[model samples]
Target: MNPGSLLAYRHVISNAGPSDAAPVLVTDTFPSGVIFDSAVGADCTGGGARCTIDRLAPGDVITFTVYGRTDTTVRGTFVTTATVASPAENLYPDNNTATAITTVRIFVYLPLTLRSYRP
Candidate 1:
């Protein structure tokens, strides 16, 4: 993504269990390069860091779309993290968190002048 451009992040949460998971909570932490704009989802609210799901049955899936704008002066790469939690007992804690790394590409424009001479 380029500087000052809009960026969207999609997070897919799935329940791969023999039981239903209730009261699931999803949280995200945007890096310095991203200025959080908004979020779109069933239980998502205003702002940029958290989402909630009342319940998720077996083989059920939910998703959240998070939007943000790239900082004009930001360069290089930035990292963002998202995590999910539930009241139900979790066997694999390692799969509860996800990380994304994004690289920013910048373009510079310079003024050009043309000169003419009489022959």
Candidate 2:
């Protein structure tokens, strides 16, 4: 497939309210072990005050274009960790801690075509 035609997308699924929270996207290539791109707090997950496929809530889904373009096809690992803030009544109100990571899902989105390398 045409690398330019392919785009990367992502979303954060949670069971809480005010889905306005921000989401971060990180991409890492395998074998070579490299991070091609990393976007922090990208508001591309919902449409308004939201971005991506749709307005997502708990069990909802969304998508975004993380890699707008590429010259070749490669394999990599995508790590998604949802940084959330706990309520004041919770044990730990601050969501910056490790325990606050609510949802994390990883998968591979392949382009329409694959590029081959010659030995």
Candidate 3:
């Protein structure tokens, strides 16, 4: 990704339990050099980084997309993490958290200086 460019992230959550899971809370924080833009799916708030799901039935899957813009002056590797939780205990806890990393690069060009000499 380049500086000042848009960066998008997608997150998918599924309910694997046989029974319905309670309301789920999904949260993500903008990484350094990133500014929140927009989000799709779920009731997103907190600068489009937080979402809440009323309920998730068994075998139900939900997807979310978050958009952000890179700071024009910032360049480096930015790591963003998202986590999901439910009021009820999750049968599988190992997959509750996920992360995405993005690297921003910028290139610069300089013109050569020339001088004229007279004899």
- Residue 11 miss distance in model 3 (angstroms): 0.7
Models 1 onward score TM values of 0.83, 0.24, 0.82
Q: Rate the local accuracy (lDDT) of all candidates.
A: 0.82, 0.32, 0.82
Among all candidates shown, the one with the greatest TM-score: 1
Question: Of the pair 2 and 3, which is ahead by lDDT?
Answer: 3
- Per-residue accuracy of model 2 over 34-58 as CA lDDT, tens digit each: 1224233344332112222223343
Per-residue lDDT for 39 in model 1?
A: 79
Model 3, residue 96: distance off in Å is 0.4
Clashing pairs in 3: none
lDDT tens readout by residue for model 3, 22-55: 7889888778777777788877775637788899
Alpha-carbon RMSD of each model: 2.6, 12.2, 2.4
